[model samples]
Target: MANSPHGGILKDLYIRDEPLKATLQAEAETLPHVVLTERQLCDLELILNGGFSPLQGFHTQAEYTSVVTTSRLPSGALWTIPIYLDINRAHLDTLGAVPGSRLTLRDPRDDQPLAIITISDIYTVDRTQEALQVYGTTDEAHPAVHYLRHNTRDTLVGGDVQAVNAPQHYDYVAIRRSPNEVRQLFKKLNWTRVVAFQTRNPMHRAHRELTVRAARMRHANVLIQPVVGLTKPGDIDHFTRVRVYQAIMPKYPNGMAQLSLLPLAMRMGGPREAVWHAIIRKNFGATHFIVGRDHAGPGSNSQGVDFYGPYEAQDLVLKYRDELDIEVVPFQMLTYLPDTDEYQPINEVAEGVKTLNISGTELRRRLKTGAPIPEWFSYPEVVRILREANPPRDHQGFTVFLTGLHASGKESIARALQVALNQEGGRSVSLLLGETIRQELSSELGYTKRERDINVARIGFVAAELTRSGAACIAAPIAPYNEARQQVRKQVARAGGFYLVHVATPLEACIKNDRAGVYARAIAGDIKGFTGIDDVYEAPSNADLVADVTKTSISQIVHEIILLLERDGYIGDR
Candidate 1:
């Protein structure tokens, strides 16, 4: 393994005892052509360069052998039961990152070791963005849309929603996170053997019943990762659905289940979506997923094959089960019982009209007005969430936080911190100079760099405020806070990738060159506390640059900063 041509990463990588890749390559070597996406190509390049490591996996024969005995998971069902699997159709339907099963593989019975077999490859995906041609119709008020519209008003946030903004499409569901994060989250956890349940509807009693039953049957933990975006014709507004989800969380058995929201734009690719759904779940750490009739239908197709039957989805899930690494817990339609006033599986319900039918049209009508949703039909908590998310229309601003070292020239590299606001006043990027901010924290204390960081965030509020005012400000403060920087970075990352600049000025020069007289005061004991004198500075290892202020002049420094800004495309390309 060490002598392998791929270089040093093979040793560091999770090397399987019985290299499954060879066998996987053999078994899948002749399968329908496997293409690599740009991201996947990037990952492969990195792997060859010894920058990334592939997850190690153990071999298993679950697909060949039948499931034996195991205790039920938190949902309370026997574990390791037989499940129908489909071996064809691009493994799981989705390719890009849309949250269903994208790639499949095999997991050991204990659910710890995983064998990597398939992956979501290829960059080319359908990009048609016909605005949400969904399945149901909005009621009189259309509360779901109304809810989105209402909350979108005057929240007063910052960042570009268009330039960095990306709208979702179902056909091109790519794997979103990087390979490293994917390995850490998806492969590290002990979930080689599991079952997954999918849902288009919000948490109704019958839905929970199905999931609970599936968990019991597989003796696996249940990942109730719900779809939190647009659905087929007339789908419930995501916001409302999210609210309902938040409300109904407690109803789920504590540890066995967890929730994540999926943001997808609707397309009527039912059977295809079933595949897509499985892959996304695989990306998100689920080893199984549920698929049913009309998995990704828009309204109802004329052929009325219902997109794909529940069983078709089952077959698809199984065929590529190894590629998916997860199992599908296919549940037949669930229904509500009026007499018992409880939800039951369709298999258990008595004949005739007593079987409660759940329809998107009906659900929308009930949600339009603030009607009391019955527990028997749906969990009460989920209903409360529905009310909040049931409206539509425009959006307010979102959040943006800046990270990086104070001197790292992040702001300067970004030129985000303009000294003269009056210069070219029309530009959106405003500069928040840390030089000016230090005045807010008198030099008398000779404040440590950490103290300066706390001050930076305190001032970040001011930056945040300025951003909301429709001006993207460039702020620079000698903020020596890696953690705080991360916090701000995450806030801004949702809006756009944060630009970090570590003004790498050596201590000897930075202090010798101090214009604020901080070094002079610290050296002479005039200031008992100074950043480098009394405190520490954890140099950034992965900084975008090492702006050696020690060797460069201010003009040259600013020029480099401008170049950085141009490189990041924050400003026009130089």
Candidate 2:
């Protein structure tokens, strides 16, 4: 039989009463609302669907503290991760939130109310403490830690959430099963001994081999549950991964495996996350879960050390095996033996026999360069799917973001680069000048820091879309703040390459070359909050290339940018 949920009871919090749901929805429309972030939305979906069983709502301060410090809920249940409804202080005050008050949680993509929470506690948290206790690091290099420090808000409001409606998901509707639905399907299939395989990456030949081997070893059927929600920052997007999963489904022996999608916002917390994954799988009706080396591990710290030991996840899952009520199937790195045409665990391989393997980095490199991938490494259909999703770099899209002081020849350089790319003629090139974007996109915005950030973000959105559609986009906006530039970089990076070029022309040189005389007016106090005058211009320290217009002509600078792109394989040799 399938193991029981983590707390022996599944907490499906969705309100089934039609009249009550309508009443709550109507009341929520009048209440102060918090727009949920992507991670929060994912968490809310699972919570309402009983995937995160035993919890009916976001944790109160005490529960959060208990989970953080002791890796357990207040009731001593093994809940390693904290679920919070984080809000900024300004928003908290705006809502006038207090105990016994109600607040609506709306989707950011659209203003649809998904749930209403009765505020039970309103408190602030020490983010650094939470980061250390939950993610084991305060270093911002870790993705989850970075999110904790920067992206997440300071204050957390805890309450019992009443779901008016489940979060809407239009994709993969057939495979996106709730806990109850999955349990029913397992029962229908008579799958009592089911082993779950958790993955956040595209499955390959070796992955199939290991999963099949694991199921056989456990004497159980297989549940290929891949995460479709937020994973590591640079991981392949879920759409492509899902397509790959679909293509690989027929390869599994008939009736031996099933596929399900988990809308989980992974912390990449390694050992603790592995235990958490096992519990979630158990709630989904799995009798066992496979924990591999460095399970859910974020790559490396800034100091170039792994956040957790390779076997740490396996060890932790084993430690909690009895309490978790699920078997922990441990597997090591698997490599292919060409002579035997089979895969074996690294430790099980003989000393003299030849073994082959491909790292994720190597696989990406091969994909980007359109290099030949050996059939032994991946199935042809899988490789074909990945190749289609990730075309050769020359055919892929990219962005060149130019940021510097006003009148620093950024516009001229950008125009010249656009012409150069047009002449090369592989892809369409777009030039987004600061003044043009200001007049067209942000006509009502001024030169304040926040407005400038919004303007730059608008430019980034356009550039990112263009890049995603396989175009070369050159944006020359005087993005003065490092934070805004970094945000643009991240936005563009999701599609393809992002190159930041710093036109490091000095203040005196910019003033000397000023054609608009705006800089002089700002110096004369005719303009308030002018960048580089009353306002500060935070130059980018992480630029891919730095050009000084005083030292080089615009044409030469454009040539240098082209060379940089060519060197990075964003463009091919002309």
Candidate 3:
């Protein structure tokens, strides 16, 4: 029989009363609309489908307090994570949110009504306490802590959601199984003893060996469950990772393993998250769960220290194994014994024995260099999928972002570079010069700080999309703020390589060389908030290439950029 759900019963809030649901939907049109963020959407779907088995809706203040303090619901059920609906303080006041108040929850992707939430409590949150208690740190470097400190709202509105419709997904329909579906699948497969393995990364030979070993030791079938929802920033995207998973599924012994996608928006909460995952897997009918070193750990903080101890997740899961109702099958890091042509736990190797292991950084470097990835390290099919997702650096798309003073030879250098690249004729090149982008993408945006940030963000989005499609994007914007420039770098880096070129032409030189008289107008007080005249320009300290247009010819500048690209393997020798 399948293991019972976390709270002994799965919560179902789908709108079964057609007439009442119709009335609620119509009434929602008249009520305030609260668009669900990605995290909230994941929570809502899981709640509706009983993946978050006991969570009827977003938590009230009492439940939140209980869960955070004790890792248990108010009903004394195991629920390590707190699910809350947060709204801006102003929005809460405008909506007159109080106990018993109703609001419409709309999907941000489609603006379709997904649920109607009745406010049960409105309470202030201590972000630091929540972060420290839930994630074991109050540091903003932690992604969840950062979200709590900066992105989330000050006021949290607790509510019970009545589902109008589950959120829609356009991809991977067959394997996007709900808890009930997974339970049914387990039954169909006669998987009485199942071991669940959770991951946010692509699977390779080491991972396969680890999971298979765990399943064998536990005498259970394997369920390779990977999170397809919001993982830590900079993780391999689910689309690519899922393809990698599909490629490696055949390597597992027939009838010994299965693959499923879990739409979990992980907080990277380390130890607490491991317990949460165990309870979730138990609800999915798994008898055992594999928790390895640093399970679900977000790599490190800004200080270069691990957020959790290496064995912290395993220890915590072991502490709650009985209550979680799932066997905790802890495993050590696996290393390949090249001599034996197999893998074993790193700790199990003999004192004089040699072992082979590839760090993630080393693997990425090898992939970028098109170096040999030995078949012993990973299967050829798996390597092929990864190589396609992350092409060799020279073959991959990239963005060259130019930031400088308004009249600093950025446009000229960009145009010259575009022409030079076009002449090379290897890849598609796009030029987003300052004036062109201001006229096209940001015509309505002004030069205010927020507007400038938005403008740069728009450029980043465009560049990232183009880079993903294997096009070289040359974005020349007077992105004067360091923070905004850094944001764009991070955004574009995810899709492809990002190189920043600081066109460091002197301010006086730029003003003197200006033919459009925009800089002169800014100095003459006709133009307000112009960069480098009245407003300050925060120069990039870590630009990949710094070209002084006054000292270097345009051709030289273009050559310098090409040389940087070539050095970085974004382009072949030219």
Candidate 4:
């Protein structure tokens, strides 16, 4: 039989009464509204659906402090991380949100009301202390720490949440199971002794071997519960990972394993996260959980040191073994033994035996370069899904972004690069010049810092679309702000390669080379907010290539950029 929920009962907060939901929906219109971020939305869905069992809503100040300090709720239940409803002071004042007031929480993707929170406490938290206590570090390199410092607001609004509706998910609806639903499925399948495996990455041959071995060792069935919500910031997107999971499902032994999606926003808290995962699995009817080395670990910190020891998660899970109500099935690193055509734990492998394994970094490199991935590492179906998602660089799209001061020869270089790419003829080429984008996409915008950032973002959006469609995009925008440029880089990089080029034309040279009198007019105070005169232009310090028109010909600079693309396998050598 399945273990009882964390606090002995699963709290399904979704209001199934249609009339009450309609009443709440109507009442929500008159109340102040709070739009949830992507992470918050994921958290809310789990909270409402009993995936985060025993929790009724976002944490109050007391609960937050208790969890942060001692890894326990105020009720003394084992809770590892804090779940907060963060709001800025401006929003709070605008909403007039005080204790006893009700606020509707709407989805940010669409302004659909999903839940209502009756405010119980509005307070601030010591984020630094929370970071140290929960994540063990304040390093910005940690994705959760970075999000806590930059993305999250300081003030937290705590209350009991009433769900108007579950967050609508259109993808993989069949596999998106709530805690109760999974528990019911396990009951129907007669899977009493179930071992759960939590993963955020795509499963491979080793993962299959590990889970199968774990199930056999425990005499249990297996549940592959993968996080479909916000994982570590550069981790594979959930869509691709889910498809890979789907492809690899048949590889599991018949009646031995099942796959389910968990909408979890992982904190990457390492040991604490592992414990939390075990508790969540227990709620989902798993009597046992497979805790691998560095389970839920977020690689390394800023100094290139691991955040936690290899066995820290396993040790912590074992420490709370009695209280968690789930058995920890610990496993070491599994490597393929070519001699026996099977996998064995690294510690158990014989000395001088030939072993082969592919690291995640190496797998990604192989995918990027169209190198062969062996059947020993992954199934063909799984490899096909991954390859389809990540095509080789030569077949993928890319963006070349050139930014500089006014009249800095960026447009000239962009046009030349576009023509060169078009002549090469593998993929369509797009040229997005700043003036053209200003006239077309951002006509209503001005030259203020905010407007300029929006303009650059608009160019980035179009370029990102072009890149996603397997085209070469050359964007010449005076993307003066480094932050905006970096944002564009991230946006385009998600689709394909993003190469930033700094057209480092000297300001004096720009003034001399001006075909129009805009630079002179700006200097003479005739043109207001003109770049290089009244407005600042923040140059990119991390550009992939730096070109100066004063020292090199346009053809030579274009050739150099092509060479960069060729070096990265985005283009074949001419």
Candidate 5:
């Protein structure tokens, strides 16, 4: 039989009765609706399914403090991550939210009612304390820390949640198992000794070999469980990773392995996260778990230093092995031995053997250029899926964002490029010029810093959407701030490509070319915040494409851009 659930019993919080569910759904409409964030939705799914056993809802202040400081619940049960519900201060008055009031949590994607929570405690969030104690960092360089610092609300509302329904999933329904379902499946398969492998990335041959080795050492079946929920910022989307996982499943020894999807929103918390994962897998009926080097690590800091020591996660998981109730199978790094045409654990390899390995960065570079991924490293089928999802840079959708002072010929250049791309078109072309965007997409936005940031963010959202549909978007906005532009780049790059073009035409040249009298008006104080005069324009120090309109003709600049696109495989050579 599978191991007992964490805290000794599985807690199913969902209201499974059809009549009760209908009543709850109807009651939800009358209550104040709280739209759940992506992370909150992930937490709700786990809570309702008993994966997060012993926790019936988001943590109260005392529980959160205990978990953050002690890595345990108030009852002293091992629980490394603190799950909380945050709400904007503005919403408190709007909804009359207060202690003793019940509110409905709705899915942001479709506004579907998922759960109801009766507020027990509403208090200010100690984000700095949470960041330092939990993440071991006050630095914003950490992704989760960054999110905690900015995205989260000022106040946290703690309550007991009553589940109405699970957050709906349209894909991978068969393998997206709840904890109880997985435990039953283990029983059906007679898999008493199962070792779960946790990953947020796509698996390759080395990973396959490593997991198989881990299972063999423990005399267990393998559970290829990959997280389908939110991961680190730049990781591949769950859809593509799921496809890769599906392709890799057949490569596993028949009847010795099974595939399941874990809806875990990983915090990349290194050691604590490793322990957390082991407990979760144990609850899912696994007898053992594979905790490799740097397990759940969040790479490096801004100083190019690793955030956690190598083997840190392994050591921490091993420290709590008995209490965790799941056996820990530690793994060393693996490399491909070219001579043997096989993968071997790096530590076990002989002193003088030829070995090859590809870094994740190198693999991404190869994929971008359509470089061959050898079979020894990864199966061709997996490679094919990755390539299909990420196509060659030339064929993929992209946005060329032009940022500079007003009257710097950005609009002209954007129009010219749009026309040029249209003439050589394979994908749809779009032009989002300054005046046009202000009129159509951001009319109510103003020139203040916050409004400008919002405006640029809106553009980024639109560009990402367009890029996902494989369009070539040309945007010419006087986006003065570097941080806003960087945010846009990060946002759009996840969907397709984003090229930042710095139109480095000087202020004098812009003044001379002011056909719209914008510069003259600013000089006369008629324009309150005209860029290059009253307002500041922080030039990009690291743009993908930089051109000076004064030095190069429009045709030559357009040709240069085309050449760049061709060289990068974003377009065909003409």
Candidate 6:
């Protein structure tokens, strides 16, 4: 019967009676495959149409020029160039991997096996490219050329934002294609090692010092790409930040560096974020991304001991370097020297003579409070940025922020949660005391509630207001019991946003840090109703986020809180 078809399943067709047996069978071996998206397909089409010219790999110098070296200053001592993240995708995605297959081959560097990954949902790379004279050359007629580029997406790859772009407040970047378009624009440049710098803060002398140091150490070019988005509240806004950066451009080594603004929403997750930042830099065609101490901390953030310490991020990058292909350019924090009145390496600060006391906060505060930023603090352009960003100072958030007890932090953050009525300009009843059990019905002050109907009322009150305002709500007055906090979380989840940020500190740590000396006095039988004693303060179970004040500053905690709110979709990503 038809020569018994082929083999077992095929021969079964001879019966011609078995279900589906009469149908012809074909052997199509199934293997791993990658799915392409409309956007990815478009990108692929552009890439293919772009005409691969002896393209070896993503960072292939033979194919594309990494143009950071000749853009900076001091001839060759320092280099900073523009960063466009789309080119970075080639760096991280193509490293030791095969396209359209999960089978990653062996590594050429170490002959080690590489993992295969099938491409899934593809994300668009917000980019546009322009042809310019390539790295190390000012001649327009040079055979090598550079392509100016940037990502369209608003996400900042590896840094936290200090503030976000506001239509009324800042100059919105124009999202326009070039009126004069050049086809096959990037065909001419010779590629070299590219290094990218990520900053939410405006570029200052200290930053410049660190960048130049890293460039010289790595023998690569530099690209200064600062975030143009929501940065930390009260920190320099992007509009002014960009101006300062642009002002300092002429001072940089010409043809050795370039400056560009990266539009991105920062996550502020410290160590992990550093990795993401490096990848973005690589996508923008950089061979390196700088990692400094507290690299991505927008506000001090609750990272008690400097956002996982300086080396942690570097370690993370090094551990995963092959996957990212972007080198880790690590260095100590840069500080300004006063005796010589120049920026110097922190390590080179000769013991403790200078004791550079200037900090971003001190600088911002001095500017905001109407004090001049000293030359020792930042570059003149940087001062202008801070001066313009100084705007107005609101200290209501500061008094409570400056309270001196463990109980104060818990109280402040809790109290910090306000209702729409309390919105600065809402003109509505500002602060309303949200409590569970009404004191009118209570005879015993502390003992009688027994945790019954406690959190429910508090949650109801908070949720009702949040639902009413269509914004997040806050409930103060120690939410020590885990069950009570869970109730609040559940209630808030249904309404809008719910975050259990346990501003925790070890009892001993708190006592040691008890600036009010409440702990010592409590031991001497002075103060009663103290949390963790007299009043039971149950530790949180599985808190959504924790602002451990044991070592972090209030600014940092606030930054983390903002990040937590953004992550939970409670607050806008700005």
Full-model lDDT for every candidate: 0.45, 0.90, 0.87, 0.89, 0.88, 0.45
| Backbone clash count for every predicted candidate, in the order shown | 88, 0, 0, 0, 2, 49
Per-residue alpha-carbon lDDT of candidate 4 for residues 1-574, written as tens digits (9 for 90 to 100): 3343232467688777889989988987777899999899988998898767778999999999889999999999999989999999888998898999999999998788999999999999888998899999999888889999999986899988998878888999999998888888887887778889989999999999999999898888899999999899888889999999988889987899999999999999999999989888877878889999998899999899999999999999999999988888999999999878999999998889999999999999999888999999999999999999888989899999999987889999999998898888888898899899999999999888888889998898999999999999999988999999999999999899999999999999999999888888888899898878888888889999999999999999999999999998899942
Residues 1-574 of candidate 2: C-alpha lDDT, one tens digit per residue: 3453232457688888889888998998999999999999999988889888778899999999999999899998999999999999887888898899999999888779999999999998898898898889998889999998789887898978989888878999999999888888888988878889989999998889989998898788898999999999889999999999999989999999999999999999999899899889888888889999899999899999998999999998899999898888999999899899999999999899999889999999999899999989988999999999989989989999999889999999999899899989889999899999999999999987899999999999999999999999999988989998898899999888899999999999999999889988999999998888888889888889999999999999999999998998888842
Indicate which candidate wins on lDDT.
2
Taking every candidate in turn, the Cα RMSD to the unseen true structure, in Å, is 21.5, 3.3, 3.0, 2.5, 3.6, 20.7
Task: Please give me the total number of clashing residue pairs in predicted model 3.
Answer: 0
TM-score of each: 0.37, 0.89, 0.90, 0.93, 0.87, 0.39
Candidate 5: where is the Cα deviation over 4 Å?
A: 1-8, 403-412, 419-428, 432-462, 477-490, 500-551, 563-574
Worst 10-residue lDDT window for candidate 2 reads 1-10
Worst 10 residues of 1 by lDDT: 156-165
Candidate with more favorable, higher lDDT: 1 or 2 = 2
lDDT of 3 by residue, 408-473 (tens): 999899999999888876789999987888899899988899999999999999999999888899
Residue-wise C-alpha lDDT for candidate 1, range 1-574, written one tens digit per residue: 0111111122223334445545543543333322322222222222222222221111012311221222111233222211111222343233332222223222222221122233222122111110111112222132222322342122111110001001223431432332233334433455444455555666777667777777777666665655544454355655565556556657768766655544433334444346556654554445557665445544333444343344655675566565444566666777777777766667766567576675767776666434456667776566667655552111111122333333333444445335432242444555556666667543443455556566766655665555444455565566665666655555544333345556776676565555677677777888764566665555655555466655665557556655654454344411
Error of 3 at 53 (Å): 2.0
**Candidate 2 runs further than 4 Å off:** 1-11, 402-413, 445-455, 477-487, 500-555
* lDDT score, candidate 4, position 276: 89
How good is model 1 by TM-score? 0.37
On the 0 to 100 scale, the lDDT of residue 399 in model 3 is: 92
- Shift of residue 35 alpha carbon in model 3, Å: 0.8
Clashing pairs in 5: 394-569, 394-570
